[model samples]
Target: MNLRLYSYWRSSSAWRVRIALGLKELEYRYAAVNLLEGEQWSEAQRARNPTHQVPVLEVERAGQPPLRLVQSMAIIEWLDEVHPSPPLLPATADGRARVRALAEHVNSGIQPLQNAIVLKRLREKVPGWDRAWAQQAIAEGLGALERAVADGGAGRFCHGDSPGLADCYLVPQLYNARRFGLETSGFPTLLRIEAACAALTAFQAAHPDRQPDAPSSDPATSPATSPAAAPAAAGRSP
Candidate 1:
């Protein structure tokens, strides 16, 4: 299993990739791409991903092109597809659909609206967009997600008693939400799921603050962060 993950320590997408790798118990090499320093823009990374993103999965075989894959969601699903050790998708089609829906709520909906790029754009244009609206948008999205999850499962994790791809995506989105000082106190389900994730070693090992490149606690680190963001959770099961 000659696998390599092109990662940024603080990237939520990269974080997702790390969680997927850890949950699957796949030992892969790590290649750091410093997003804060524009290292992702290098011709080398661009040749690999073409999207200029972190968390590129370089799947090497005995002799192959070393298949470089991008987009965190695709990478995670790919891991599940190839490994299939602990299935990331549920057994039934309906179960798989439900989990994917919840995951997409964060992946497709919330993430794009309040992404780093969007935040940077808003920061330059509007005065209060930096902390104010970003938090609001994130909260609103999470609120909707909470409602959606209510229609699914919220047992120990987002989709079931164990974590899946949905949980991986959810935790990172929640982490980013908290980064903007969003009021998640109203979202009890989200909080509970986050708690469940924190108690597990896999999730604990994948935390951003635990990573080397993550910054120290600072008021200017953004308004949405708190001391209570750390937690552990489960993953694909055999």
Candidate 2:
């Protein structure tokens, strides 16, 4: 199979897919989508994803039309099933459900509210929109995540000793939370799992600052300036 990933350098959703690809050891061409500059809304990109979001995975096989996948979670799950070694989901049904639930706590609950477009909208529509609103949303979601991990679902990495789906979701959200200045001092188990995941080369390589599209000098200093500067935010998946 041939694979190509359309991603933004700093997008957490795209970062999640990148981590999954790294863990699965899948090689793919990187197509940088500059979200901050509104490149995602371009006609060509819109053709790839109607929702105009980053992290579209184009899959090609020997005798089939190119499969265009939109959501980050769906793309990662497909990769886990097709690749199979070092499985991302657990073996048992209960285990898979738990992992999926943990992942969704971030994917569905936290990520949607913290997306760039949503925040942008809130800023324009709401009265005196502040970064505090985003921070509060992040804090609430992360609090739940902390409890989930502390309650029973965490090990060295969110499920068991090895990093899996939940770790994929956890690491990126933590990255974004830090970007938003959400204090994470309360979530020790989440922090511990994040630290464990960070030790892995896959997670390190998939980091927002490590992407080719990110500015070589400083990723945070520049944004909404160039494609290189376009990465410093969270994303929505079409």
Candidate 3:
């Protein structure tokens, strides 16, 4: 199978897919999509995903038409189904539901509120609302996640000792929380899980700083770098 991922370096959703692909030990061509410069609105990108989002996956198999998949959660689930050696979800039905619930706590409840497009719209209508809104959303969502993990029989990772779907959703959201300047010391459980994930090469390779389109310098200080202009060698492997 030939796989290609359309991703933005700092996008939490794309980061989730990156982590999933890495954990599955799959190699794919990295096609960088720069969200900072409105590249996601381009004709080509829109054609790939009408919603105009990053983390679109293109899959090619023998004697079949190529498949274009969108939405990070859907793509990751499909990948997990196709490649089950290192399962992303638990084996038991109840366990899968628990993990999916944890994953949705981040994917549905939190991410949309702080999404770039959502922030941009808020900024246009209500001046100076983006940062505080994103911070609150992340903080509240993470607070709930912390309590859920604390009560949900969490072990080394979110579900059990294994790093599964919930962990894949989590680490990136924590990154976003930090980027938005939220103090995360309150969520010790989530932080502990994040520490465990940090030790894994899969999570390390999926980090925003390690992406091909990431700026050479600090993204906060450096001017926006176009993915089209950058070389695609950085994310060639896990």
lDDT of all predictions: 0.76, 0.82, 0.86
Badly placed stretches (over 4 Å) of model 1 are 215-238
Candidate 3 per-residue lDDT, tens place, 99-197, comes to 999999999999999999999999999999899999999999999999998885799999999999999999999999998999999999999999999
lDDT of 2 at 20: 89
Best by lDDT: 3
Ranking by TM-score: 3, 2, 1
Question: What is the Å distance of residue 20 in model 1 from its true position?
Answer: 1.0
Ten contiguous residues minimizing lDDT sum, candidate 3: 229-238
lDDT of 2 by residue, 153-229 (tens): 66798998888998999999998898998889899999999889888878877877766678682533312223322
Clashing pairs in 3: none
lDDT of 1 by residue, 1-238 (tens): 5677777667888888878887888766556677878887888878988888887887778866668888988999999999898888899999988988988888888888887778888889996667777777788889999888876576788888988888898888888887887767888888899999988766876777655345752322211212212122122111
Q: Model 3 compared with the native: what TM-score?
A: 0.92
**Per-candidate alpha-carbon RMSD to the true structure:** 7.1, 5.7, 3.8
User: What residue runs in model 3 are displaced by over 4 Å at the alpha carbon?
Assistant: 217-238
Question: What's the true lDDT of residue 12 in model 3?
Answer: 95
